[model samples]
Target: MSPVFAHGQLRLYLLSLLNEGPRHGYEIMRDLEQRFNGLYTPSAGTVYPRLAKLEEEGLVSRGDDGRKVTYTITDAGRAEVARRQADLGDLEDDLDRSASQLADEVRSRVKGEAADLRAELKAAAQEARRVAQPATGEPMSGRARGEFEQAINELRQSARSILRSRKTAESVRAEALRIVHEAKRQLDQLK
Candidate 1:
């Protein structure tokens, strides 16, 4: 459910959208998705049914554009749009607020998660160096240094792969935590 369309707002907004010009179902869906900054996308199941209902209500007329159905607002629909001018304004404001809030939340979470991952990686690198260095103050053997570097490189590549994938902030955070815990467990077992 979209925070932008809480009640019958979607219906009115759809009518308003048609008032602008005749649009195909996909166009309407794309416009809505763009309006919400890609945060909310209405599926075909959600959009087509509402368009069918609007046609049934005589508020909109449907025409065939090649194989596609395009919706155009009727006089009644225009009247409805004019009648609910204030509602349209309110809906626009709500959309603006919702999009801004979602963007801010994503930005904040990404920053925090990146910082946490950086700290964990730094700590792990420091620990690896400490372990590689012997207590006798002797320099680390070539084999020990190579192993440590390989492990750190693998960890860095894994983190990069995870971050590059598309996922919600919560899921990314959870996965990062799990990876960190698993790394710690493996390091402990090596003791």
Candidate 2:
């Protein structure tokens, strides 16, 4: 659970989601994950209990669609959503801040790891040079260049593998476009 949502914020947000359409527990979780750009996903333990509470409170009704149970917001839930529309806005702002913070943290961590890797490679290169020096005191340019090339190739392969495993290039481009559109919207709001 992210602290981004205050005490009862998740409950209200769930109602808002149901207000849009009826969804099972898993669908709601997936919706939240997608909304946050895969940054936050609530587990069944978290969502199911909350749904049960909402049903108990008469704010939402549950219907069994085959074996899956779907939740629909009742009139009471819609009234609550209407009453706290401003709070929903605040929830959106909180999610934006949380996503930005998480992105910053990931960026800084990757930068630090890359810097450390560079330092280690430099030290290893120096040690290799000391060990490979001939008695004639000649520079081992050929060997050093080969080793550097191999290291670069290995790094390239690792990067390519990661990119291939994580997502398709098209999906990455789509996500970038989504972010750009969101930024444009925020800028337009300012004007």
Candidate 3:
């Protein structure tokens, strides 16, 4: 997952959130998720530990009601927030950019998958046509059928390898090799 905050930025952001008003831990988490446009949601393990640390540092105080513990910024926490106002602004900008980038990546991936589906549909249509009307009105010879199945198997293997590598340079190289091999096979078939 993309990081929503830099190393020390979450602590500062939490302080700023509390500076706005007292909030329960779940409220803080939901507020953060909203702020990031649902791109990020902090787990309880992540937020509660940091809150505990802030309490230890005397920057925040927690009040336990029967069911929920609400946290409020201490005077020191407000002062810290005020002092780092500029830093907080920068953090907000970074978070906005990160969310936009993540959204863009998701969109691009969906487009790619759609394109792949279209190509597969086209290939299946072509294969159906070939099967329905053979060149000599006869089924493919055993050797020709074997070659066709081998080619399909190779294509599946290449696709699996590429997906496993996730578009890395090594996967790109493997794709190139697969293309070269297929080209050579086609040339041999022509002869």
Candidate 4:
């Protein structure tokens, strides 16, 4: 699961790294691991394909340096990097929130309550957290049911909060419904 996120992060990091100057693929990978505190290291199999995609998208241009692929970001690539920079938080926030969410759920569920409820909730939460987080420091990504549910829950809570603040019941319902529609769009992206 984390491979997908790593792939995306690697592409962005390469773009950012090459902004300093054109660099070979190995240099970009080394720079990414350094920046991430050795948290992520992409295999050649992963990095090359994404580089190919970037080249295909015209975000990257390659210079011949013997057998090495030296990549320079094009004007279009620069624009995409900028656009992604703007939407970057939306992508990043999911991983960020997922981490804190596990701790928060653990804290809440472990608090005083009925024994069965505590035990059951704790076990379920633990399993979910384990599934969400990778053994390595890299985060889990890819289209999966867990992420879809989390996104839906986020939208549902957003809607409920919006609904709560409204003065009229009709407005509240309308706003919540709008949020639900937005949630569906988010889910569709996973597919």
Candidate achieving the largest lDDT: 1
**Model 1: lDDT to the true structure:** 0.80
Q: Which ten residues in a row have the lowest lDDT in candidate 1?
A: 165-174
lDDT (C-alpha, whole model) for all candidates:
0.80, 0.71, 0.74, 0.59
Best by TM-score: 1
What is the per-residue lDDT of model 1 for residues 1-191, given as tens digits with 9 covering 90 to 100?
Answer: 22656678789989999999999999999999898778677899988988999999999999996899899999999999999999899988887887888777777777777676756665665667565665578888888888788768867775876667664465666667676776667666555
Per-model TM values vs. the true structure: 0.65, 0.62, 0.60, 0.43
Better of 3 and 4 by lDDT: 3
Per-residue lDDT for 108-161 in model 3, tens only? 754565455345434533443344325466777777676667655665664565
For residue 71, model 3's alpha carbon misses the true position, in angstroms, by 1.0
Please state the error at residue 102 of candidate 3 in Å. 1.8
Q: Give lDDT tens digits, candidate 2, residues 31-123.
A: 988887875677898889999999999999999979999899999999999999999999888878877876666556555544544454444
Clashes of each: 0, 0, 0, 0
- TM-score leaderboard ranking: 1, 2, 3, 4
lDDT score of residue 73 within candidate 2: 96
Any runs in candidate 1 off by more than 4 Å, and if so which? Answer: 127-158, 161-163, 167-191
